[model samples]
Target chain A: MPAQSSPPRTDSRPGGRSARVRAAVHQAVKELLTDEAGDALTIPVIAARAGVHATTVYRRWGSVGELLADVATSRFSGDVVVPDTGSLREDLERYAYDLAKDLSDPDTLALVRAIVGTGGEGAGVCRMERQRQLEAIIEREQGRGNQVPTIERAIEALLAPLYYRAVFTDQALSPEWARTLVSHLLPR
Target chain B: MPAQSSPPRTDSRPGGRSARVRAAVHQAVKELLTDEAGDALTIPVIAARAGVHATTVYRRWGSVGELLADVATSRFSGDVVVPDTGSLREDLERYAYDLAKDLSDPDTLALVRAIVGTGGEGAGVCRMERQRQLEAIIEREQGRGNQVPTIERAIEALLAPLYYRAVFTDQALSPEWARTLVSHLLPR
Candidate 1:
């Protein structure tokens, strides 16, 4: 018989076994995305890579699309910070610049491709979460008395272009391109 | 076997055997996208649908991605027209509106996702063709002495956002949204 830790605590705290499991799964996903672009990512494969039980992984994320979205949500937050440059235009411009810079990475682009092209109910959930994050940042700017477009409008104008160049086209994602988005939106 | 026409003519005019073959293949791709959103489309399956020889299909379009891109290029031109209404703002607004309208269709969206997520090599060619078509329209506008943003900037600001909304989110595409894009760029 194999010695195993006590059954996973159902009521674990923030840094408990549950969180560790999530971190391990996320790490495995990051590694897989890095090691193999355009590879089919199954939960079983991810569990094997993470040294976690397949049942546990399956219990949390039922489909590759769900897992992919979770990975993107985690990575997107860590990579992009909401710009807080006092003025709304400057804040947006700076944020857009950073976003473009981060999204330029091949790994990030691949992650985005997964989210954007992963068509299903899981992708729907992912889009909702992602859109909320984007709106929260925009709302914060509006709260600071900076006039901004609607959240949907801002996403379409500011964020979409960066992603377009990143995944859809073979174009460079320069900071200048981000600035161009800001200039178009907030014509100084 | 049923009677077959002579070997496909290498040098056929616009409405000749070559044109007919291309049309059939494009039509088959369209039907497949509509009927089966996530079906793996092989050269043989597509050939059977188009009633064209598998070798002929393979010779012209080496891969599914290539065939899909051709379908998109053909459809993109027909569905979207360069807005030639007098004023540049009006032109862009109308063009953006039409783009959003056309992109909202399920079939068109599927074709776009196919190209965008087709990974390396294939996506590059599709993007290049799409960008060229966009440039041609913008160039025509610039030729008319409209002080528009560069072709690249127009794409970033105007085009990318539409695709982002269409494919990346569950938001509805509206003509009003297109007006917002135009206002953001060419303010009255």
Candidate 2:
């Protein structure tokens, strides 16, 4: 991991006392969302949790939806790393296995679930961000001159079963499951 | 689609007005959760919508978490159809392409986003029902007696790209996307 003097700020807006307060509020909100699970989260409650004034929350974000989206962006940070392992099959298998592990993690799962559930303005934003991540990964792999669509399809095919199992089915996330998905799904 | 029928009753106890009310309440609750996005729902609002007393909602579901899970089971009516296409690749590709189409529909996407956004309770129920569907498809393919995990993996591989694109990325659900995913992912 790159040594960070502070958490990387992707937003280009000026960083000041307000930015610091917003960051703190977002961290508090994320923690509460993870811990409380379905409990009604109010602005006052978040303000108390973050040790900030209620006005700070209102002035910076205006609504819980905006705050949640900011938190979602921070929590589900990083791009999908695309790998080049010579063959499309190897590359896809690795991508699937890695993504399965990431999606299965409780923290990532919660944030993803929240984004999926809260499908208002935030949901659309999260969906678009996720798309950007995929496009970035595709560009990286395509730079290597592997057939873009084929490689992209191969990677998606390999990862989809584990996700289907993890998110929509009851299958255990076993090495066998990953390997089977790869072996059967990957072009020989 | 199966012949339409009245919603099922939830009471077996004799001489029960409360039971009838409860049954009506749950049925209405189920529709609200499944038929719409999460943003449009609230317990008080649901009670008004169902024409049930608000106290009943608290007594039966206790929390949104429990209510959400119940809604998922009630909404999921049945499984996917897996046609025997004479070859594993054909069968897998057919299933993949069809499932992709099913998933891409607006109602299904809304349900998926809602179920995923909530928590593990709804997620678990949703996954179990889906597994039953997928397993039925797999078992039929296996019953042809040429079945292997590799075949299953390949089928999953074939379908994963469409879903990954739909769920994790913002790609348009084009016929070309479907063909690209299936052609590269499906085993010969």
DockQ scores for all the models shown? 0.38, 0.37
Per residue, candidate 1 scores C-alpha lDDT tens digits across A1-188 of 87677885666566688788999998887787666343445677789989999999878887666777778667755444566666777777777877777777777776666555455444454345445656777788778786777876777677788777777777787887678777766666
**lDDT by residue (tens digit), candidate 2, B63-138:** 6667767766665555555557666556555666666776777666666656666565776775455445555656
Quote model 2's TM-score for chain B. Answer: 0.65
Residue A27's lDDT within candidate 2 is 79
- Which ten-residue region of model 1 chain B has the weakest summed lDDT? B117-126
Best by lDDT: 1
lDDT of 2 at A179: 62
Among the numbered candidates, top TM-score falls to: 1
Worst 10 residues of 2 chain B by lDDT: B146-155
Please give, for residues A10-88, the per-residue lDDT of candidate 2 as tens digits.
6545776667787789777777768865655567778998999988898877766677778767655566566566665
Instruction: Name model 1 segments beyond 4 Å from true.
Output: A1-60, A121-138, B1-64, B77-80, B121-134
